[model samples]
Target chain A: MRPIPPWPRLRRGLEHDYTILTVREDIVADPRTGQEHPRVRIDCGDWVNVIAVTREDQLVLIRQYRFGISAVTLEVPGGIVDPGEDPALAAARELEEETGYVAGRVVALGSVHPNPALQGNRCHSYLALDCVKAHEGHPDAGEDIRVELHPREAIPRLILEGSITHSLVVVAFYLEHLRATAPR
Target chain B: MRPIPPWPRLRRGLEHDYTILTVREDIVADPRTGQEHPRVRIDCGDWVNVIAVTREDQLVLIRQYRFGISAVTLEVPGGIVDPGEDPALAAARELEEETGYVAGRVVALGSVHPNPALQGNRCHSYLALDCVKAHEGHPDAGEDIRVELHPREAIPRLILEGSITHSLVVVAFYLEHLRATAPR
Candidate 1:
């Protein structure tokens, strides 16, 4: 494993639809380095993730039926950032639109790949704090999203027992833990 | 948010093409109570995840180009278990196929939702240890997956800086943390 493999993407193709979420395709180069490689490529995507913390120190969460799993799931408020939009702003707008809360400060926690293999999306996570309830909720046409608040410490128990299942929510909590405890 | 809101299925869809991650409609009666709700539903497909650890106390990871994000991703060797395939068996096969390493023992860590909202995939994780190089590497199509070994502690560093962006990888590391620090 000397000089860990360098993944150089030769090129990419990008397009999007103005739907509930936008999907992009990246025509990437293969990384096998010379000598008769397989002549192959891949595509990936990003997702914008938000961690909205309320004034009472509770996390503001949205429970909605995810069309993918067909299960009613609880997740931190977030969505795909439009192609030209800043992810942090997208996080703020999504949190407000989905949960009706406004944050006084928004900090970039980190970014993640929702799935790094066959789709194109990045999950940009943010820590929104000192939130204030701003507007009356207006869920989209097919949205059955309900809001929920939970104690921060109870996260581990929920994860261990199969309560919170959303990928972004779990990662957000873990990132929060890292921020709260990691060495500066 | 007193008493968390009952989860209800608002929409449903099915996806076969990996790119679109499409959603169709499947409505039931009662979402929380399992009663029938006549509505359109989206069926997010199932997903599989694994955490493969080797005997050297290092993790066996695959660094390959994932088309979805158009980036080189470093992840544990894993993929969706074929229909009716035992998760542990799938873990072993994935480990061997992706990294050319075989496991001596496989343990079930847990299962999670990648994104309970848009994905119906259940991310199943496994802990494989006492592994040995079993054969020459064989990854599917244009996969320049270089298998690397990482000391367990390095996981935290990678996650904090956003190198380890895959949700399944983070949860597997968390599962590993629970095992290492939990009462023996």
Candidate 2:
């Protein structure tokens, strides 16, 4: 397929800084008709999520209250990847911090753009095998999390039944499924 | 499992309106300690995407330039659900408008929160069985899209090969897979 030409930036507009994300506006001209339009862009740090499984094949999951949704959600351990930090190490750190699960081995599964239409960040997924509890979890000041362990086979059912509804979490499991089923 | 209590809103801070999304800040008190903290929230309309398959079993896909990533991306046809519009109907409308494909029948696959930590919206997925070209697509003024068809079996490879990197698209395909493999 031929590459789609990108729009030319006309000027930069206002920018608003939130703690986790920054919103900015850019004026750009369409390549086809040269029509100018203002597009909103969200700048965020790359994120990392781990599909950590125990030696007994139990999946480590977390239930936390998300402020945006105003409710608790079931998701994998994840957080923003620190600046200049390796995504694999970030994945391992997040896993251990959120659930106290230390990984025996960590490997990258894949990555995806959370929302390329408005966000410029990637969320990297990792598989942490043979995980075991190392210490008490240390959630952030605003975070309250409960860790749960389930059979790895129940992931598909959890997702299908809507118990797990975070898009990034679902993508992580999907990537893990692809890796497990791939031809060696 | 016990339910996690929600934080109480202390006050509303500021709100900024963007064309596609609205950003606002809310001051809320933690349930455990009553400590107040500011949280950023992004308000967006619900969204819908269609996994359209032709009678010949070819998957309908589209390539379009996303301003957020500043590049072209391979994705399925989708758009924000209009106010009071049924998500299934919106899915069909988006499919027709973005790719000019009309579905013989449409069924709901499932839904997921795009980001419950920051965005309060759901992205609903649908399966459009037996889709066919109806007319030339009519994308929005800022949209320029190219439609392509691929065998349904190639989706996993496309995703794994990083040709399709949108989180919502990956979630949609994962939901379809769960539906296809569910025991009756």
Candidate 3:
């Protein structure tokens, strides 16, 4: 496959800052036609999510009210990767802070651009093996979360039944599936 | 499994309109603390993506330039679902228009919230079986795409190796995996 040329940006300017994300507008010239077009990009820090599994082969999950949908959702513990923080460490930190589960070993699963078409940041997913409850969770002031544990085998069914509908959460599980099924 | 109450929205106002997405700000009161907090939501039409498979068992995929990431990405054919349009039909239309592959039959795999934490819209995925190339693709004026076909089995490795990194595309494949592995 031939490499596709990138569009040249004619101009760019910050448009809005919404606390969680900042939007920018860019006028880019198409490589093929040299036609200028307006495009919007959302900027934010990278994020991390962990598929934490305990020694009992149960997965630690969380339920929280998401304002966008105005409903509670089942999802893996995750948060933004703070400035100058390693993604792996962020994953471990978020897991413990949100669920109070500490992992014996944390390994990188994979990372993907949440929405490359509109967002510039990536969301890294990690696998935390042999997790154990250390203490009650310490959710942030704006967060109210409930942690739950389910058998590892129930993930696919949960996703299929629409019980777990977050795209990033599902992508994390897909990465875990690849890790488990990969030829060693 | 206790029920988590939704936050009460005290006020909402449109913040920005970025063509593809509109941002709105909401003053929501925490159900637990009754404390008011500002939250932002991105509003957009629902989306659809198709995992098109040919008679020869090859998967139809596309490469396109995404402005947010400022890079060409390998992804499945997809686009926004028009108002009042059926998601399955939208999926098939996207597949045909973006890749010029007409499916013999299309089936709904599943639907997911792209980001329930920040976006209200759902992305519906479909499985388009026995697709055949009918004509050259008709991408929108702003789109420049290259279509490719790969063996269906190559999906896992492509995803594992980071050749295919779109979260929505991965979710579509994960849905297909769930469909294939579900017990009769």
Candidate 2 chain A, run of 10 with poorest lDDT: A1-10
lDDT of 2 by residue, B20-119 (tens): 8999989988899998888999999999989999989999999998988888899999999999999999999999999999999999999999999989
Clashes of 2: 0
True contacts kept of 3: 0.83
CA lDDT scores, all candidates in order: 0.69, 0.93, 0.92
What is the total number of backbone clashes in candidate 3?
0
Tens-digit lDDT string for candidate 3 (A64-134): 99987889999999999999999999999999999999999999999999999999899999999999999
Per-prediction TM-score = 0.78, 0.98, 0.97
Mind giving the per-residue lDDT tens digits that candidate 1 earns over A1-62?
Answer: 54335445444445444244444444444445433222122222356778888889998877
Clashes per prediction?
Answer: 50, 0, 0
- State which candidate, 1 or 2, has the greater DockQ: 2
Off by over 4 Å in 3: none
lDDT tens per residue, model 2, A132-177: 9998798788788899999988988999999999999999999998
Interface RMSD for candidate 2 relative to the native interface: 0.7
Q: What is the DockQ of each candidate?
A: 0.42, 0.87, 0.86
